[model samples]
Target: MAATDTIFALASGAGRAAVAVMRLSGPASGPILAGIAGGLPPPRRASLRRLRDAEGATLDRALVLWFPGPGSYTGEDGAELHLHGGPAVVAAVASALAALGARPAEPGEFTRRAFLNGQLDLTAAEGIADLIAAETEAQRRQALRQADGALARLHDEWAGRLARLLAHQEAAIEFAEDGLPTDLDARARAGAAALRSEITAHLADGRKGERLREGLLVAILGAPNAGKSSLLNALAGREAAIVSARAGTTRDVVEVRLVLGGVPVTLADTAGLREAADEIEQEGIRRARRRAEEADLVLAVFAADVAPDAVTLDWVARGAVPVASKVDLAPAPAAIGGTAPLPVSALTGAGLDALRARLAEEAARLAGSGDAALLTRPRHRAALSETVAWLEEAESAPLPELASEALRAALRALGRLTGRVGVEDLLDIVFRDFCIGK
Candidate 1:
C-alpha cells in the first residue's frame, strides 16, 4: 500500500468488549481525526469527544488522542480512538473514518510503516509479531528481547565493523601509489577472518533459538500395547491419544502441546513400532519410525511386564530415552539397551512427576533459556550464513579488489537481515504473517 494513503484499522481484539482502539496513520491522520472528533485533541493527551459523520450524524463518543508527525509510532501523524466496543459502535466509527478518506489497513501495515519510516528495523518488526503470537513464557521473553532490538544491535555492530574493513580495503586499492600503509589489505583480511570466526561460532548454537521459537518436537515410539499412548495422555493431563489393549490401536500420530521448563513442546504419540501382517499396521510402524527420526527427542517405551523388543531396544541404543511403562504390572528391568529405563505406571500416576522433571531438564538442555540474544528465525540464519560465506571469500580472495567486492556483498546480506538496504521484496514476506494493525 502507498504510504501517502491514510490507513486505519481496529487495533484491539475483535468482538464485543469494554473498549476498542482504532488506530490511524498518515499525513491526513491528524485532519481526519480532527474532523471526526470536532478538532484534534491536545497532542498525546486523551480527550473525550463526540465522533460524528460528515453529515453531522452522531456515531459514538470516543476517547481520542492525537500524535503529531515525525514523533509518532510510524514517524508520521497518528491517532487513536478508544470507543465503546459494541459492534454497532465500531461499525459506525469505521464508516465515519472511511468516509473521511482513511482506508482499511492491510495486515501488519502499521508495523510495516514503522519499519519503512526508520522507527524500527525489520528484525524488531518480526520480534513484535513473534511477541503477539508467543504461547509460552520463554517464547514471550525471547520475542520481547528481539522486539527490543537485541538482535538488531548485535547485527548492526557486526555490519559496522565489516563496513570499516571494506573502507580500509578500498583505501588500500585506491591509494596504493601514495603508500597508504602496505599492511592495510592484510589487516582487512585479518579482520574479516576474525568476524567470520565469531559468526561461525554463533551458528554452532545447535539451533536453540529456532527450537525455542518454533517449539520442540518429542516423539513417543514403542511396540503395540506398550503404553505409549498412556504415557502421552498422562504427560498431557488429558487423553490426547487412543489407548487400547488391541495391537496397533493407534494407527497414526497424535500430538499435544505442553510447556516444559517454560519452553513450548509438541509431544507426539506415534503408531506402534513392530512387524505386522496387516498393511495398515505396517504403514503405521513405518510412520512411527519416520516420526522418531524427525523428532528433536524420542521416548522409546518398553512394557515392564514384557521383555524388551529388539526394535525398541535398537531405538534405546540410538540415544532415545528408554522408558519402562506399565510398572504397575511388573518390575522394570535393571537396564534396557545399556541404559537405565525410567519406570512409570500411567494408570497409577506413579513416577509421572519424575518423568516430567526429566523431560523438562531435556527440553531446557535442547532449547536454552530465552534470556540470551539469539537468532529466532530461519531467515536470520540464512542471511548470516550467506554473510559468513562472503566473509570467507573476502579472507581468501586472490586480489584486494576481489576481497573488497566480497566484503561489500557481505554487507548487503547483513543489510537485508535488518532492512537497511535491498529489502523491498522481503518486506511482504516478513510482514504477511502479522495480524492487522500490528
Candidate 2:
C-alpha cells in the first residue's frame, strides 16, 4: 500500500458502548478529518462536529480530533472520530471514509506504521501488542515496561558499548605502530567481560520471565480427601470446582487462572490419585499422574490428620512441594528433607497468609528479585542465551580482535531482541499475535 493512502480502523472494542472510536492515519488524515467533520480541528485539538456523507446526509454527531503530520502517531498525520456506539453508526462512518479513499487497516497496521515512522522501536511496538493482549497483572506490567522501550534502551546501551569497543579494536589491529594504546587487549577483554556479565545477569532468571509473559501452569495433586479442591477454591477464593465429603468428587482436571503472589498461575486442581474401580475414575487418576509430570510446581496436599508415610514418599520424586492442608483440623506436617511443609486451610483462614507469603517468595525468586536483571519475554531469553554463548568464546580466547568480533556477534543477536537492525521475520510473528484494531 502507498504510504500516502490513508488507513482506518475501529479503534474501540466492537459492539455496544457509550461511544466508539475510528482511527485514520496517513498523509490524507487532514482531508479525511475534514471530509467527515466538514472541517478539520486545529492540530492536537478536539472539536465536536456533525458528521455527514459526501452528499451532506447526516451520519453521526462525532467528536473529531486532528493531529498534524510529522508530529502524530504515524508521524505523517492522524485523526480520531468518537461516534455513537452503534454498529450502524460505526459502519456508516467507515463506509464514508472508504468512499473518500481510506482503506481498511490490516491487522496491526497502525502500530506497524508507528514503528516505520520511528515513533517506537521494534521492542516497544511488540510491547504495545503485548499490552493490548495482556490477560494477567504480571503480563500487563511486563508488556507496559516493554512498550515503554525499557528493553530497547538497555539493548541500545550494550550495542553502543560494543560499537566503541569494535572501533578501538580496528585501530589497534590496523595501526599498532600508530597512536593506538598498548592496553587495547586489556580494554577489549574488560568491555567484553562487562557486557557478558550484563547478559549473564539478565539470563539468570531461569524461565520466570517466560512464565510471566505466558501464564505459569501449576498442578494440585495428592491422595483422596486431602481437600485439594478445597485448597484450589481457597487459593482461587471461589468455588471453581465441586467439594465433597466423598473421596473423588473431581474426576477431571479443573483449571483456573489466579494471580498468586502477583504472578499469573493457571492452577489445575486434578483428580484424587488412587486405585479406582470405575472406568472414568481410573482414567482421571491416569490423567492426574500425567499432569504431575508436566507441572511447573506440584502442590501435594494431604489432610493434616494424616502423618507422612512411605506411600507419600514414593510420589515425592518430581520435586513436589508437600502441602499440609486443613491445618486447623490437625497439626501441620513437615517437608521430607527440604523447606518445611506449607500449612493451609481452605475453610478457615489459618495458615492461608503463610501460603500466600511462601508463594510470593517463590515467585520473587523465580523473577530474580535477588538479581538486578531485566528480562521481559521468552524471545529475549533466547537472544540473551545466544549472546552469552559468544561471550563464552571471548572469555576463552581473550584476543582483542576475536573478542571484538564475538562482541559484535553478541550485539547482533541482541539487536534481534529489540528489532533495531534485522528482524523482518520476527516482526511477522509479533504482529501476527496482535489484534487487528491494535
Candidate 3:
C-alpha cells in the first residue's frame, strides 16, 4: 500500500529449477541492486554478477538488470536477479534484500503500482492476470488482446463521447440566458440515444467471450444403454468414465477437460435419461436433465443397434447433436428425428475422428475463435449494462441539467469498466485473485 517502500518477490515460479527470478521495484531498487550485486547494470541490459550475502560471503553467480524510474514497469526504479534456483540460494538472497530495506511484495503489488503510475489501466491489469491463467490457444489470444487495451480503447472511446456531450450540454446551459439560437441540447440528446443504441448492441453478443474465458461446457445425454460413457471415454482418449452393459452405471456427472478448436472445454458425461425403478437411479436422471439445461451444447447419443428412443429423439429435435453410437454393431440410421445422426463406434474407434472434428466446429461456433475483442468477464457486462441505462435516462431527460447529470453518471460507470476513474474499491477485488509472484 505504501508506494515509497521497496518490494521484492519471485517473479518466476517458486521451486528448485535452472533459474529463479527475483524482482524488485520502488525507490530503493537501485541501492538494493548495488547492495547485492556490488553495482547496477546498464538500464534494461542484463549482466552477470557475483551475488553476495550480508557477511560479504559469495551466495551465487547470477544475472542482474536495473531499470531507472519513470521508464520501468512500475514507473519506479526496478531490478531483476536471475539466480540459480535452490532453496538455500533464494533464502540467502532474500535475507540480504531484507537487510538492505526491501520487503516482500503483496499479491499484485507490482502491477498495482504500475496501474497507479499510469503504466496500464485497471482493465489492462485484469487482462494481465487472465493472460497468466489462460489454458488454451484461444484463451491466450483473447487475454493478450485484452491486456493490450482492447476493452480499454472501446470504453475510452465511449467515455470521450460522453464527455463531449456533457460539455455541449453545459455550453447550452451557459448560453441560454443570452437567448442564443442554438440546438446543442437537441444534438446532445441525439448523441446520447445513438451511443446508448451502440452500447446495447455490444451487450447483445450472446456471452461468447465470457464462455471462452471461463471455458465451455458440453453435456452428454442419452438413454440407459446408449453408450454415453463409452463415447466420453473414447473422445477423452482415456477411461474417464466407467462403461458397463448394465444400466445406471453412471450415477453422477463425470467431467473431463480437453481442448477443442483451441478452446478449453469441460465435457460432462451425465447419467442416462430414463424412467428408473430405483430411487438412486431417479436422482441421477434428475441430475442429467439439470446438466443438459445448464450446458452450452448437448450430445444426444443413441445406440445404433437399438430402436431410436423417443426421449433422445426429442432432444435431437430440440437442437442437440444426434450421435449414433455402436456403429460397429449395426449400420447407423439414415434419419433420426428428421436429421442424419453422426455415426461413431465408441468401442472400435470407428468414425470417432469425424465426430471430434464436428464437435470442434460446434465449439468454435458457440464460443468465439479469438477473432475479435469480447466482453470476457461478468464485471464488463454489468458495467456496460449500467452505462447503457444511464445513457437512456440522459436521452429521455426533460431538461438539459438532468441530462448532463445522467451523462456524468454514465461516464463514471464507463470509467469503472476501464479503471480510468473511481477505482478505489475495485483494486482489492481485482488484485486479490492474482498469484503472489505476479
Candidate 1: RMSD to truth? 6.8
What digit string (tens of lDDT, one per residue) describes model 1 on residues 1-438? 338889999999999999999999998998999899998789999999999899998898889999997889988899999999998898899988999999999999999999889899999999999999999998899999999999999887888778778877876786675655578899999999999999889888889889999999999998889999999999999988888889889998899999999899999998887778899878888888888899999999989999989989888888999999999999999998789999999999998999999999998888888888888889999999999999999999999999989998998888878876543333343335423232
RMSD of each: 6.8, 7.5, 6.9
Question: Which has the greatest lDDT?
Answer: 1
lDDT of 3 at 401: 89
Estimate candidate 2's alpha-carbon lDDT, on a 0 to 1 scale.
0.77
User: Model 3: per-residue lDDT, tens digit, 1-438?
Assistant: 338899999999888989999999999999889988988888899999998877899989999999998999989899999999988888889889989999999999999999999899988998899999999999899899999999888987777677777767766776775687779889988999999999999998889889888998999999997999999999999999988999889999999998999999999999998889999889989999999999999999999999888889898988999999999999999998888999999879999999989989988988887667789889999999999999899989998889988987888888878776553333333335433232
Question: By how many angstroms RMSD does model 2 differ from the true structure?
Answer: 7.5
Report the lDDT of model 2 for residue 97.
96
Worst 10 residues of 3 by lDDT: 429-438
Clashes (backbone N, CA, C under 3 Å), per candidate, total 0, 1, 0
Order candidates by lDDT, high to low: 1, 3, 2
* Residue 194, candidate 2: C-alpha displacement in angstroms: 2.6
CA lDDT of every candidate: 0.89, 0.77, 0.88
Q: Tell me the spans in candidate 1 whose CA falls farther than 4 Å from its real position.
A: 179-181, 421-438
Write down the worst ten-residue block by lDDT for model 2. 365-374
